[model samples]
Target: MLLKKLQLKAIDYKFVLTVCFFLFFAPIVAAQEIIPDVVAEKPAEKPSGGKLKIDGIIATVGDYIVLDSDIDKGFLEITAQGGSIKDITRCQMLGKLLEDKLYAHQAIQDSIIVSDAEVRGMMEERLNYMTQQVGGDINKVVEYYKKSSVEEFKTYFADILKEQKLASEMRDKIVKDVEITPEEVRNFFKKIPKDELPTFGAEMEVAQIVVEPKVSKEDKQKVIDRLNAIRQDVLEGSSFATKAVLYSQDPGSAPNGGYYKMTRKTPFVKEFKDVAFSLQAGEISAPFETNFGFHIIMVDKIKGQEVELRHILISPTVSDAALKEAKERITNIRNKIVGNEISFADAARNESDEKETRANGGTLVNPTTQDTRFELTKMDPVLYSQVSNLKGNEVSQPLLNTDDKGKKTYKLITVTNRIDEHTADYAKDYTKIKELALKEKQINAIAKWFDAKIKDTYIKIIGEYKECAFANNWLKK
Candidate 1:
C-alpha cells in the first residue's frame, strides 16, 4: 500500500528494500531502527523571556539555547494529534529537543551539509502525508499553526527537515559499515529468552499465470474513439466527473467520479502521476494508457505539497490470444529449467523481472521473515492460489498474478524452497541474531561517543530538562 503511494526512484526503493530485508531477518536491525524514546530535560531558569543574546547559540547543551522556535515547532508537530498537552510532559519533550539540538549543532560544526533537493523531497513527502492525515485540508493545517498560509509554514518545516536529516545522517554514518558474522549471530540467538521472542506474521507461497486484457489494434481504436467522444463531451459541456463515474473500470476511485488525493512521491504508475500532475485545476487530461487501462484525469486542486486530483481508469479485457501467448512463454521458461538446459536460478535471473528475488538466485523469500518459510496469510491471494500444495522444486501451473503494488501480471511459480514450523536453532537462525548483536554494539559505541563529546563542548539546558529521560548518552558531561 505504501509502495503504491510512495513510488520511490527504483534505485532508492531497491536500496531501502535491501535494508528492509536485512532488518527483518536480523534482530539488531529491529532494535536499532525502533523509534527511540524521545524526551527533553529542563535547564537552569532564565528570567521570563529575557531575549537570549545572539552569540550564535539557541539552547545550550551544557552551554547550548536550542532555537526557541525549534522547540515551539517541535511541540506543534507532535501535539497535532490533539488534546491538552498535559498527559505528555512538555518539559520532557523539550529536554529531548535540547539533546537533539546538541547533536544537530555538533553535526553542523563537523561540516555536515544536506542536499537541498533531498531535503525538499523528503519535506514534500512528509508534508503531503500530514496534509492527508489531517483530512487533506491544508487550510486547517495552516490555521492550526496560525501561519499566514501553507506557504508561510514551510520555513519552519524546512528547519525541522534539516534537523531530522542531520540526525539521520549522523545515525547512518555511525552504523553504515557495521557487520554481523554468522558465528556471532548464533551466539546472540542462544541468549534469547523464549517468552521474549518475536512471533511471525502469516505467510504465503503463491504462483501466478497472468492473463492480461489485451487491446487489439481494433479494440484499442474503439477505446480511443470512446475516450475522444468523452473528451468532446467535456469540451461541449458534458462533465468529466459524470463520464468517469460511468466508464472508468479502475474500481479504486470510479465511484467518486475518479478523483483521489495524490502526491508526487506516490507509487502510482509513473505515467499516470506524471500526466495528472501536469494538468491545471479543471483541465481535463487527454486520454492516457497505463498497465491498468486508459484514464482521463481532472485536476481539482493543488496545495503546496499535496494535490487533489481524480481520474477514471478503464481496463480493457485481455484477449484469449494474449493470455495464451503469456502462458506459452512461461511454459517454455519452466520447461527449460525442468530439462536442466538452464538452472532454475539462472532462468529466473534471465527471464523473471522480480528485482527483489532475481538478484538473490530466485529464492522466494517471505516478506515478513526474510526467510523461505511464510506463515500463510501474508501471501498474495492470486499467487497463493497456484502454489498452495507444491513441494520444494515443484512447479505450479501458470496463474494470474499481481505485484504488491497491483500491477497485473502472470506467473508460474516453481516452489523451490519450503520449511515446516519448528523451533528456531542458532545454527539455522544465526544470520538473524547477528543483526541484533551488531546494533546493540553500535548503539553503545555511539552513546559513548556522545558522552565523551559533551565534556569537550559548551552545554546548557535552560529549563532543568537535564533530569528528564535524556538518552543516557547525553548526560556523560
Candidate 2:
C-alpha cells in the first residue's frame, strides 16, 4: 500500500497496477517517492501549556472506526513528505484510508491469514532499509520515531505494517489475474492521443553467468581455528558479547552483541537452534558450522522451550588465489561461448554458480517483474555500466562482485536485447501497453467494487469532515 503512494517508472505489471490505481484517483497531495521522515505535529496552543487535542473517532466503515488521531497521523506522515493539509486533502486521505480499511475488513471475511513471522520479517527488512538510509545508524532512526529502542519502534509500527500488508494482499487478489489481449493492447494504444503518448526509457534484457570461488579447506580450517581461539578466550573469562560485537560477521545480530530470542517454534536453522537450546544458561558451546559460517554460541537464558543466546560468527576468508581462479574460470567460459565452442545459455546452465538464474540458463530475472528484461536505471551501477556499451548478444569481461548470499564471485554479463527510449508503440511496446490497459480495467473493477462495498457497509462521518469534497461516491448514501 505504501508502494501505491509512490511514483514508479519501472515496467513491472503488478506494480504497474499498484500505482495505477492511485493514479486513477487524484491524490490529496503529491505523495513522496521515498519514505517520508514522519515527525509528530505539536498541537495548536490553547492555554499556558497548550492543551492537546483529544483523539476520537471521526469516521466509521463496517466494524472499523477511523480515529481523529489516525487522520492526524496520516496528515503528519504525508505533510512530512511535503504535502499540505487542507479540508480537501484531508478528505482525500480519509477516503484512501477508508478504502484500505474496506480491503482489510474484506480480507478477514475471506479468511485470508498473514502470519506473525511474515509480518516480523517484513518489518525487519523495512527497518534494515531505514537503518541503511540513515547511514547505518539505528539510534538515529529510533530518535526519529521518538522510540527508546529499535524493538519499541517495531512494536509501535507492527500493527500498521500488518494492516498495510493485508490491504496489499487484498488489492492483489482483486486484480491478480487481470490480463489484456493483443487486440485490447492495440486498441488501448490507439485511444491515446497522438500528442499524449507516454515515452519509455532505454531498457535491456541482460543475463549473467556467475562463478563463485570455492573456499579451500585450508582457509576453512583457518576460520575454524580462529573461532576456536575465540571460544577458548570466552571459556577463559572473556565476555562472549564483547567478543561477538568485535568479531561476529552476522550484522543483523552483531549490533546487539549477537543476541537472539529463539523458541523451538522460531524458524532458525536446526544446527544453530539445536546447539543453542541444548546449552545451559551461561554455558558456551564449542564452535559449530552453519551455511553462513562457523559460530560459537553462548546461552544466556532458557525459559521453558525458549532460549536467549549470543553467538560469534566468523566467515572464512576467500583467498586472492581463489578469487583469481574464479575470474579465470569465468574468463574461460566466456571465451568458449564467444568462440562458439559453447552457447551462452549452455555455459550458464552448466557453469553459473547463481542458483536463481542457473535454471533459466543465466537469465537474470527482475525481482519485481520476474522477467529477464530490466530498465537500465534499475540495475546496479557496475552491471549497468559494463553492459551499457555492449551490443545485443555481446558479453562483458569478468567482473568481481558479491553474490546475493554476500559471497565473493566473478561474473560475465550478456545483453540479449536493447530497446531505446521511444514513444509507446503498439508493435514494439505490446507488453507495456497491455499493462496500461490492464491497469485501467483494474481501476474500473475496483471502483465498482468500492461503490457496492461502501453502499453495503456502515459509514458515518463527523459533521466537520462532511463539508469536505470527496472524489469517490463516499457520500452517496
Candidate 3:
C-alpha cells in the first residue's frame, strides 16, 4: 500500500528507491547498477512489435532520453530488491525516471559541480567493496555484473553514478536552508490527530568509566621499532602499498593498500592530518601515536588541498599482568563508587582513561540522535545485555571489553536516566517533534520547487505514459 501511494504520488520516489537498493544491495553499488539477479528476470511485458522489442527511446526530459530498456530495468531492479511489481506499472517507472532526469537537468542549469574525481572515488570504493565480497577476485566481480572487463563495468556505472549525484545535489540545494521554529514545531504537533501521536520507546542515559590496559615501555618501544623498520624498508625501495597490504593493522584500509584521500577538513585525528600535510609527496613520516595505535604514513600525491596517502599501523601488545592490573583498577573504582567514597562523575573526570567520555561525567551521547538518551529497544545487543537488569543508579560490575583492534579495557556502567514508554507529549518530546517538523518543511520545499520547475522545463512523456496520473504537474497542464 505504501509503495502504491509512493508510485502514485512520486513525491519522494528517489528516497524509496534508495532504501530498497541499500537494504538489499548496499556496499555493492549505488542504486544505479542492476546486479545479475535483477537483470536475469524476464521483462515485465512482452513488446507488441519488433521496434518496441529492439529498445527505442520512450521519453525525453530536457537533455536526457529515457530508454525503453530503462523502464524494464527499473522493474527488474524493484523485483530483485524484494519489491512487488504487481501494482507498479510501466508508466509509474517512466514518471520516476522523468523526475530523476528533470532534477539532473536543473542541477546542470544551476551550475552544480560534481567533480570527476568524486565520481571516480565513489567507483573505486564500490569496486573495492564488490571485490571483497567475491573473495578479492576482480574477475568474479566483472563476471557477476555481466561486463566484459573491469574498466567497461566501471565506465558504464560511472555515468549512472554521476547523474545520480547531480540529481541528489539539486534536491539538496532546494531545501538546504529549510528551517522550522519552535512555534512551527508546536503547530505541526498540534495538527497531528490525537490517535496518530507516535509512541516513544523506553530509553536510558548511560555513563561509564573505562580503564585501558597500559602497555609497558618495552612493549611500546617494540611497536615503534617495528614501524621504524617498515619505514626503513619503504625508504629502501619497497612498495609502500604492498607493505601496507601485508602488515598494516588498520583493518579499514589494509585491504585497499592502506589508501586514504583527505583534505585538511577531513575528520582524521589531528596528529594524523598534521603529519600527512607536513610531508611533501613521496616523503614518509616517522611513527606517530594516536588513540588507535602507532602509524607511519607516506604521502603519495598532493592535489590542491587533498592529499592521497598510504599508512601502516601497529598496536602495542598488552601483557597479562597489564590486563590484570587494569581489571583490578576498575574493580577498585567500582567499589569506591558503590561505597559512596566518590561519585561516579568525579571519579570519571579524575581517573577514567577513556578520553572521549572522561569529561562530562563519562556520559554517553547516542550517535544516532546526538543526544544522551538511548532507546532500550534499539540499544546494541551487548550493551543491552549488560545494563538491562540493573536497578536505578546501580553500578554494574567491572566489564571487560575488547575493541576491533584487539585493545583490551575494563569499564563500569550505570544508567543515569531512564525514560519510560509513552505517547508523544508536546513539551516532553519537543526535540523529536522539531525534527519531524523540519523534515516536513524540507519535503514541502522540494515539492514546491519541483512543481514550479516542471512547468518551465521541457518534459514530453512519449505515447503510452501521456495518460498516466502523475503527482506532480509534469505535463504542464
Q: Quantify all predictions' global Cα lDDT against the true fold.
A: 0.58, 0.71, 0.78
Q: Which of 1 and 2 is ahead in lDDT?
A: 2
Better of 2 and 3 by lDDT: 3
Show where candidate 3 strays beyond 4 Å: 1-56, 62-65, 68-117, 134-140, 169-173, 236-238, 300-305, 455-458
> Best candidate, lDDT-wise?
3
Off by over 4 Å in 1: 1-96, 130-137, 144-146, 190-362, 366-407, 412-423, 473-477
Better of 1 and 3 by TM-score: 3
What TM-score does structure 2 among the candidates reach?
0.64
True-vs-predicted CA distance for residue 125, candidate 2, Å? 4.6
- By TM-score, who's the top model here? 3
* Stretch of 10 with least lDDT, candidate 1: 24-33
- In model 3, pairs of residues that clash are none
* Angstrom error at residue 164, model 3: 3.7
